[model samples]
Target: MPRSATDLLDLSELPAPQRREVRDFVQFLLTRQAGAKKPAASYRFSDLCGTMAWKGDAVAAQRSLRDEW
Candidate 1:
C-alpha cells in the first residue's frame, strides 16, 4: 500500500509561518498545473511571408557583408 501526500506530510509539526508558506506553494503548484492543461498559443510563419520591405540590391549587400568578414 502507498501512503498519500496528507499521510506522508505531517503539517502539524511545522510552525505557523512555515505551514502558510507550504500552503501557498501548494496553491501555486495547483494553479500551474491547471495552466499547463490549457493549449498553447500557436503561430504561423507563412502569415509573415510578404510582410517585409527590402529596398537595396540583394547580391550587393551579400558582397559588402562578405568583404567586411
Candidate 2:
C-alpha cells in the first residue's frame, strides 16, 4: 500500500520509454490543474456603455413613455 507518489513510482527502475510516457502524463495533469485554477475574465457594465446605437433623443423618449403610462 503506497502512501505517496514517490513510493508509488520508482522512475529509475522503469524503462526509458515508459519513463518518458509517465513524465508526459504528469506534465499533462499539471497543465490541466493550472488551467482549472485560473479565474474567468470579469465583465463590467461600463464596457457596454457606448456599444448600442440610439436612434432618438433619450430624454424625449422617456418623457413620451411616461406620458403614455
| Candidate 2, 1-69: lDDT as tens digits | 646433457899889999889878877887898898999878887678856778999999999999998
Worst 10 residues of 2 by lDDT: 1-10
Q: Backbone collision count in every prediction?
A: 0, 0
C-alpha lDDT (0 to 100) for residue 58 of candidate 2: 100
How close to the true structure is residue 54 of candidate 2, measured as C-alpha lDDT? 88
Off by over 4 Å in 2: 1-9, 41-69
Q: Number of the top candidate by TM-score?
A: 1
Candidate 1 lDDT by residue in tens digits, 1-69: 986444556799899999878877877887899899999979787697846677999999999999998
Give the per-residue Cα lDDT of candidate 2 at 29.
88
Model 1 pairs whose backbones collide: none
